[model samples]
Target: MDAAPMDATALLLADSRFPGGGHAHSGGLEEAAARGLVTDEPSLASFLLGRLRTAGALAAAFAAAATGGGDLGALDAEFDARTPSPAQRAASRAQGGGVARAARRAWPSARLDALLAAQPRPHHPVIVGLLVRDPRDAARVVAYLAVTGPASAAVRLLGLDPLGVNAVLARLAGEVDAVAADAARHARTAPEDLPAPGSPALDLLAEAHDRHHREEVRLFAS
Candidate 1:
């Protein structure tokens, strides 16, 4: 059977070429690489899998909820609560701010204006949810980005083959879809009740990366 048509907004946002400043963030992969935790394809795969289950899942759920609609302030607060590390929260908002700027120019709407009015720098997933609209599509876009950014970082940091990295992403397609599906299931769930899957290791990595970024020259912002 043929695949269902992808939402256009989801496709555009998920594109690596999107001028969303995502290329400057490694989704914590930079720190993981520095620590040798993700030095090779096998290790990278493991890191991506763990990240997908935790941080990725959390992002997907929030994106789904945002797409389904609710109190934007409540959603922002709930998302902030789930992100324990201050550095991680900063990175999220930074990315969100970038996407918001591009989105306002490309797809100006009352919904987008309301979101920015409520929280000028909304969480990345929440902004994505507003842009994409479809719960599953929004979830899938963020969930895909959650790993792809890091995967690309692996290629640049570890000198891994691009083909190999693409293959690794291909291998994880099922997991990504599963995460998006689970997130869509709770699209209309109360903001306070959204999934808050935590990744202590990622949080630590993000904090460390922030410190290192400040003290020395770092390639990616986060």
Candidate 2:
């Protein structure tokens, strides 16, 4: 199979400025930072790795499942089941809704429209998976986002060196490919059977952030 189309679509959607509103959310990095869980470059790297393995793995799998055109409703429920925190669930749907709206305008496909009609707001990884044709590429997009959001937020919140923060991402490139491949392998599996790696600490942080920052100003949405 030719890889050019898949590569291009993945690159386009992976861009932080993809009009998908991905830049508005910090992927829970802000909350972690406030709690001192991620205060420096080294801490940020650790947090990203943990996320890439847990939430990141789940996102990649779900995106790959979406690529398979499975029952999205079941997929959505499976995704929610994996996410234990209400705050995190809301964040995922909000980001999903943003990505879905942007993708519909950009791709303009019947399948995308049907996905929206089926659910007014789908999971972010699910919508991303539906937009990209290659299951591996879909996984790649979500895995990349898993780190990029927090990495970007770290730069702003901690005033960390941009060069150093990006180095953390570049260092994880191999793992990103590995995660994407692992996720794509299950593209044909039942939605309930997909990987459900969860990060309990991240979920707790998200709930804490939402509970405390309801009226306070924050740099990131989640």
Candidate 3:
């Protein structure tokens, strides 16, 4: 049987040209590339897979929870606790703030207003969850973005073939769907009970990147 239609909002948010400031950030790929960690298609696939299982899963769960609906502030606080790196947190909020701004103009609602009011710069996944509403769609959007942003950055940073990078992402499609499905299953879980799958390497990379970004010129924000 054919799959259900994709949610329009999820598609829009997942689009690279969504004007959400996602282009400026590399989702830790910049740091990994600078360290010569992700150089080609095979290595890129490994990096994306590791990221999808850890950071991607965490974001997906939070996004799913947000879509399921609960106290926004509590959710934000829980998300904050899950994020160990200050730089990573900053990137998330910065992206979240950007999405929130666009969402205010494109899809205004009391829920959005309240989210911004409580925390002007909430976590990126949280904002996505609020906007998408569908637990599966919200989880899918964040889970997809988790690797795609870094994959795009890989193209620019490594000068690898775009086709090769796209193929790598295609190969990871099953893993992404698995993560989104797992996240959707816990959409209605309590805020504190949400999963916190940590990525120590990514966190370290984010911190290193922040330091390097301050010391010299860098292409992506984080």
Candidate 4:
């Protein structure tokens, strides 16, 4: 694909406004904020970085892998293996189903429809990967999601300056590009060989949030 077209596609997929159900989720920032781990800008930045490195990297790899039109069912299973938290898994599938519905309307790909019908609720990264044809663009989409979701959450949950939060995302843009490049390199690798980086703290937060938020009303979904 041409550079301009590739970037445009990536931008469309990365847009938070794109009906991907991302607004409902905070990438576990809600739980961290409730626990006082991300009380301020610096702490929030730390949490975002940790998420970008672990969850972000893994999502990018699987997204890149999906761009190649590999076995999406197997890829979804691999994503489940990487994600230990059932709540997190459900959130991913929720977002995935939403994105799949939107992608069918916006992009209208037979492959996307088939994948969605087979899994019903594929992982978020998998649907995103199948939307864009370029593996690099797919990686970029996942990397953008990794930071933007939490950044938005910080603004709503902590009342932090939106400008400052955007700045945090801007500062990490280079790192996002680097992570996407690394993930793109592993597109041809076996799905099992794809990175399975996990964040124990985030997983624990998700589990706790799932249980606690059942009774208590929470702002974010997960």
Candidate 1 residues 1-222, lDDT tens each? 115777788999999999989999999999999998888899999999999999999999999999887887889999999999999999999999999999999999999999899888999999999898888889999999999999999999999999999999999999999999999987889999998999999999999999999999999999
Provide the lDDT at 78 for model 1: 97
What is the Å distance of residue 113 in model 2 from its true position?
Answer: 1.2
TM-score of each: 0.98, 0.96, 0.98, 0.96
Quote the lDDT for 186 in model 3.
77
Evaluate residue 154 in candidate 2 and report its C-alpha lDDT on the 0 to 100 scale: 92
Local accuracy of candidate 4 as per-residue lDDT tens digits, 111-150: 9778977998899999888887688789889988999999
Q: What is candidate 1's CA lDDT for residue 83?
A: 100
lDDT pick, better of 3 and 4: 3
Per-residue error at 127 for model 2, in Å?
0.6
Which 10-residue span in candidate 3 carries the lowest summed lDDT?
A: 1-10
* lDDT for each residue of candidate 3 in 112-152, tens digit (9 for 90 to 100): 99999989998999999999998888999999999999999
List candidate 3 segments past 4 Å from native: none
Task: For model 2, state the Cα shift of residue 62 in Å.
Answer: 0.5
RMSD of each: 1.2, 1.8, 1.1, 1.8
Task: Quote the positional error of residue 5 for candidate 1 in Å.
Answer: 1.5
Q: Candidate 1's error at 126, in angstroms?
A: 0.3
Task: Write model 2 residue lDDT over 182-222, tens digit each, in one string.
Answer: 99897999987888887989998898888777879887778
